[model samples]
Target: MSRVAPQGVLKSRRFRDYLFMTVGILITAWGLDAFLIPNKLVAGGVSGLSTVLYYTLQDKGLTVPVGVMMLAMNLVLLVVAVSFKGWRYGAKTIYGMVALSVAVDGLAPFTPHLASHDPLLAVLYGGVVTGIGMGLVFKARGNTGGTDIVAQLLADRSNFGVGQMMLAADASVTLVAALKFGPDLALYGAVAVVIMGRVIDLVQEGLSVEKVAYIISEHSDRIADAILHELGRGATGLSSRGMYSGEAREMIFTVVSRRELDALKALVHAVDPGAFMIISDIHEALGEGFKENGV
Candidate 1:
């Protein structure tokens, strides 16, 4: 009975994971079809190379759509991923790559020039849509499975980090674009890639950035009360021995949003004018009243 239950649980979890993966792939397809492809702005990884190749061939009257090229390129990269990174990593990437490829191809017929001639607007919208798609994939613990697999393999074998390896791969595509197209379009592509990457990081994490606040005050109880009553936040009290004075002290440890920092500081000041305080950014926070679990 116990073994059967475990198997059943595993199957359920796999089903849920597949659902999330499908959603991520669909969002990626929408971004490419609705924004990125329309703009001709290449982002980083295998998709970027596909964009470059699509335009290069289009000029010669032998056009291959970005989605088709992306599928082919990812298929090639999947071989390398399996050969170098072992079957586990390859297996993880294969489904996502195939799904994204199929989705992209399915979405290909609907691509229209939404941004027209406005390069800046194209870049902005393309970056945002691409970022959201990438964010969803990352949040699902799946890869777009482009050059990301190559990046990982290289990072494991070389001294470079994943980011550096990915940047190098994308830069190679941008260089190819510069040689085939003009430097201006290549530069715009680079900017679009950078913006998309940053936006992905921001979205995958949450909009409201967290900050850790430390407070040392004489009126610790009063400050804690204010934080609870006014701010509806929680705090932890720590007993500390002051290094400078060799005196006992009570410190408050709390986490708040960036917007709440000023209010927290004011509260500390109001309670104890001579309070010592420090604040630092917290990249991720998860709990009740904050970003929920698994998000």
Candidate 2:
């Protein structure tokens, strides 16, 4: 297990985390108010169920706010988290969940019903806004305190990864939505979940999607130099023996942006026309010329 940092250091780390959490909360609230609530659209998690129930009751002439239902469902999930994961895990989640609930309720009055009849537009916009919010929360290492905690715990105890577990859990909810709201709404909800998950991954990875280039060439030095000078990126040479040739060779390794990828290939081709190079996508790049530490 990873050790917890000291209280002071942890507090410093939490400053940015809290800021992101607030941003996430606001975004989620907007999504609920502007899209999901107005259109009676159900998403994937507890929020989805809350939306479903809100509309169901409203159809029967009862008026219960979705925000209230969201809070109640999250509180119930918090209890489950405490029982299964203990107080330490539950503490952070409780804070985040409560804060989000309060923000949702507070923003409720300000959010006007704009597109109550357009389900497609509601799903599109709601999914995007909610996805952004979910991404922010994930970047802060905080769960939305929905079925996410349960999914994570199940994943840890089972053979599945967290992502897989989340998919399974959300799938069950989606199935219920399909039974209740028909296939179209369920399909849209599934799309929303997938989009939301992908956006979360992208945001957590940050803006580091550089391309890693591996060059096996005779003119390794020239290629390396070109990468350094032209691409403004660093290259490292690794000594390796070719299995087929049984001779030692210097392999050049470097990372460059997707935009600079063509330039890098051109540089490599210019330096050594016959150089063997492998290029792969890098989801993130950090340090030195890239995203600096503490920035």
Candidate 3:
């Protein structure tokens, strides 16, 4: 029974991942066909390349669907991805890219142009929608398998980071867009890229503005008590020895929301004016008072 339960759980998790990938791909397709493609906003990746080719070929009297071009390009990239990263890496990516390609083309005819006359609106909405979709796909441990695969391969062979590599690859596409589509549209594409990146991060990590604070003070107990009572937050005391002072001290570590930061600071100062505090941003906080067991 125990073994069966574990297998069931594993199957459930996998199903969830595939479901996320499917929905993510569909949302991404809608965003591209409705907003980005109609407005000619080439925000990078295989989609951007497809947009450029679609228009260029259109000018040459060839009308190829953007989704078809994307799928073709992704197929070539997927071969490279599998050659280097192995078949295990290709599974989810294959599904993600193929589904996305089909979805984009399938919905293109029915999807309305959301921002046909407003370039700024197109960038904003398209970026948010696509970013959200991509983020969900990533969270499900799936890859879209275009420039992402290229960027990963480049990063493995070079000292540059994956982000830097992705930037370079995507930037090249934008540069091509600049030459083919003109500077104004290319600039909007850049803005869409920035917005998409930001939204993706928010989707993956959440928009929780949690701050981690390390407080060092003589009155650690007092400050901790205040945090527990006044702020309704928990704090831990860590034994530390100051390198410069050669004195053993207790440091207070606490996590609080951004809204409580000022109050925390004030409470700490009121307890010990000479206390040292180091505050940093935390993407997410789970367990206990924060998110309650990563829910």
Candidate 4:
């Protein structure tokens, strides 16, 4: 059977996407100003390049806003993104990139710099925040232009995907930053990169525990239907064997958010009190109800 969404649901989802991207831009800029910039840590991407150039020019009696540089560079890369990727891809990416550019500069002056002197703290916190912002962008099925666009372009012509391509491009930038800053700072920047990568995965996948429930009972259909209707989640029935009982069984499999676990339990119990039920942790759930497809 096919599930068709109502038009209102589609519109709501679109609005949610825009909100997520908007908040993501704000949070990412906050991270850049509050931690990365103060500590001179570049976590890679176009923003990282802008940070590096911004400081270099500053010492040479030139002052350019990091956000300005980012927008300029992103526009150059945006051309390539539109050329290689479709207009849909380019448009979504443009939203992210343009908003990010505005947010970084607009918020920088108001956002506080580091309060502590520890570079490690800056690296850890800054990376987490930036990663979170990027994760939100990914959740909206969008990408920020610049190296992300470049990565997609290269991935189009190469066997590697975006992650690897991003790493390669970021490495060149990191090396350049190291030359400008020093080996120690460079090492710290590398650590920030690693942390950022992990946090991106964490945010994209979610840090909270999700549950997958397996239920076996004569009333499996009743329980599954209850789950779907009450929870707004889909469930699948799979064939299974009970080796001890020498009987075939139909099992219901469903994934639910942690908050919905209790409701799911109640629904299952009400329908089939004797049902053999098992629930286990799911690290991540990606689909209609959970995470959207990422970049």
Top TM-score: which candidate number?
Answer: 3
Candidate 3 C-alpha lDDT tens digits along 1-295 = 4365878878888999999888888889999998999899999999999999999999999999998999999999878877887776657888888899999989998998887889999999999999999888887888788888889899999999999999999999999999999999999999999999998888888886999999999999999999999999999999999999899999999999999999999999999999999999999898888787621
- Alpha-carbon deviation at 66 in model 2, angstroms: 1.8
The candidate with the higher lDDT, 3 or 4, is: 3
Cα deviation of 113, candidate 2, in Å? 2.8
Error of 2 at 175 (Å): 1.3
Clashes of 1: 0
Ranked by TM-score, top first: 3, 2, 1, 4
What's the CA error at residue 283 for candidate 2, in Å?
2.2
Task: List model 4 lDDT by residue over 4-48, tens digit each.
Answer: 577877888888888888888788889989999878887877888
The CA-based lDDT of model 3 is what? 0.92
Candidate that scores best on lDDT: 3
* Backbone atom clashes (below 3 Å) for every candidate: 0, 2, 0, 0
* TM-score for each of the candidates: 0.85, 0.88, 0.92, 0.72
Ranking by lDDT: 3, 4, 2, 1
Candidate 2, residues 125-219, lDDT tens digits: the string is: 77788888878887887766887876878987999898788778788888888877899878877877776666777777755568898899989
The runs of at least 3 residues in candidate 2 whose Cα sits more than 4 Å from the true structure, single-residue gaps closed, are 1-9, 207-209
Worst 10 residues of 3 by lDDT: 1-10
Q: Which 10-residue span in candidate 1 carries the lowest summed lDDT?
A: 84-93
User: Lowest summed lDDT over 10 consecutive residues: which window, candidate 2?
Assistant: 86-95
